[model samples]
Target: MYKLLFAGLASFVLAGCSDQSWRTTDIGDIMPPLDFTLTNEEGETVHGEDYRGKATLVYFGYTFCPDVCPITLSRLGDTIRDLDDETRDNIQVLFISVDPSRDTPEVLKRYTDAFGPEFIGLSGEQAEIDAVTNRYRIAYEYGEENENGDYLVTHSSAVFAFDREGQAQFLMRDSHPVSDAEADIKRLASQGG
Candidate 1:
């Protein structure tokens, strides 16, 4: 199962994303303008609408994820660091945990803060999480637990970007260069929300 998830992630990430510019086309083929209400790392209620008027990067993964999650997040952090202050401030990264049972608000907050202060971690009741994931077509399932109660979650690995207008714009994969992400984010920041 883990292998299958990784294979899918690799395929998604490798899907011909050579263009460094923000894509305004073909967004209608998938759901656009994502919205959700969940608790942030601070344990406060946060609405997806709050991220409007800024370029937002939304990723789904748990703190316990061993490989793909951290690698992609680190790239995102580095990409943000490469941007100018004005552009950086205009961008927001949202880390939404699929494993809500183990990923409490505080835990989510602490995990995301390691990447950057600009990153916001979110998780909520199972029902709320289900709704968000289903709407976004994010495939995730919990793996069998080990004796220590540790388990792995197999989930889609892709970074989605929302323009300042709150419209879903583009997606970047793990294979994409951080510089390309920076360029795309800067382009999104320049657009009117």
Candidate 2:
């Protein structure tokens, strides 16, 4: 009987140590916690800690992106809208512009406003942007300018999700369904981390 009890106890302990099943790739142990210094859409300096109390989703993209950026933001917006009111209110989407040279504060504000109130646009000097992008392993490059001085920025499309305490949680790729994203954000919010 004692042997059976010990076996059950060990099984219970091991189960407690198991990882939570997340639809996206679990990045809790892989990525660094959320940290950055950038300017908000209102031109105010903001740090990662400013958003510490909310579950944050960070996406690196430019407002001028013709296709990928808009679609990603729209999917995130839909995910947020589908959540419960409390969970939705406790989540924020940070859109970091990779092309700060052309993405001004006013432009960022106007662009993010189209997504939803939960979406915020941020940008900064080249060095600051580079630091944050490198920290998160986000890659981006500019295409050659056209005759009209127009160019495109090729950037990584992964979105990083952080818990309320600013700890890295998971990465949402473009292929993840909106429902999966919604479920993850809901879990993060419910955990109150």
Candidate 3:
């Protein structure tokens, strides 16, 4: 399975991304095949291969995120719904936790469930999460708890859009109404498989 995932990732990077219009400042530096080892809600070991041929939307945030995370996730769902079925099938959404201390696999899964089953939530060792965040050039830092004992994680609010081949194509900045992200996803799908 790992081998197959690795092969798929390579293919995604090599596939036709010639007309990519998204910029590094916008999408990020064109990245090579990105490999990550994370466990799904079931605690089953998963790699990038499990999401083959799918344009993935990845967000790095904690489940406890009170405002931005929920708003962003709702927008993601709206963005997905805006797409037709055929386009949606070729896409996947990943909710990865930047807060490892409390976000176990079960916690991650539950958080994602509120968003939708199609959304996959993952969290692992602090070092592992940090490494991936660094690779994507996302900035994040933990915040202190309030009087109610609820804390916040201030993080980069961008959502990354990867092509079906798993190649980075666009980094949708956290902006209003998600129409921009919706447009980009459609544009990517229209580019052809």
Candidate 4:
């Protein structure tokens, strides 16, 4: 009887040690296939469905954003750069501009292109942009314009990651480390189409 008890206790301990959950906190309660229509940086219309077979990292911000946007994009760039070539090929990054009034397709392209070739910029009319933002529950308030017509936008700074199956699997905050993001992206890419 004592032998049986010892074997049972060892099994329990080993099971606990082999937990498969990701170490980083995941905020992906909503399952994916999120649909949206927006204009790409090349002045062409693009649909989210076009990325159905690939993993995507979506960030909402504007070209003129003073701090948070740049920091988040830079970190994402670093994370992508650290990924292996095959993983990088399986992933795409999108920067959606909230300030469509100022971030035209050309401006958005120039801004995102600075990060990397795989990074694409997206923008549309305020209503369309609002539709997509509302779907993701992103809040952004455009500030009053100054004498030079420059303005500020207060917005949510969350970056969303979708799996190859188009399922929302992770919501990465600005505070998360680049290594953590790279791990998540690799896992998603390994899932294949």
Query: What is each predicted model's overall lDDT from 0 to 1?
Result: 0.82, 0.91, 0.76, 0.82
Return the candidate ranking by TM-score, descending.
2, 4, 1, 3
Q: What pairs collide in candidate 1? A: 165-193
Candidate 4 Cα lDDT to native: 0.82
- Predicted structure with the largest TM-score when compared to the true one: 2
Q: Mind sharing the TM-score for model 4?
A: 0.86
Q: How do the residues 1-193 of candidate 1 rate in per-residue lDDT, one tens digit apiece?
A: 9999999988777674644335323353476686998888777888888878788888999999999999889988987887788778888899999999999988887898899987989999888899888878898999999999999999988888887767777777666666666677678766654
**Residue-level lDDT tens digits of model 4 in 1-193:** 9999999999999888744334355656753555789999888888888777778888999999999999889888887787789878888888989998889999998898899987899999888899999988899998999999999999988888887666677877767676776677668766657
TM-score of 1: 0.83
How high is each candidate's TM-score? 0.83, 0.89, 0.79, 0.86
Question: What is candidate 1's CA lDDT for residue 147?
Answer: 100
As a whole number from 0 to 100, the lDDT of residue 164 in candidate 1 is 78
After TM-score superposition, what is the CA distance of residue 53 in candidate 2 from its true location, in Å?
0.1
Error of 4 at 49 (Å): 0.3
Which parts of model 2 have CA positions greater than 4 angstroms off?
A: 1-19
The positional error of residue 142 in candidate 3, measured at the CA in angstroms, is 1.2
The TM-score that candidate 3 achieves is: 0.79
Which one is best on lDDT?
Answer: 2
Poorest lDDT segment (10 consecutive residues) of candidate 3: 18-27
Q: Is candidate 1 or candidate 4 better by TM-score?
A: 4
Indicate the residue-level lDDT of 192 in model 4: 59
Distance from true location, Cα of 18 in model 4, Å: 7.7
Q: 47-166, model 3: which lDDT tens digit per residue?
A: 766776777888888888888899889988876777788877777788888887788888988788887655999877777787778878879988888899777889988877777777
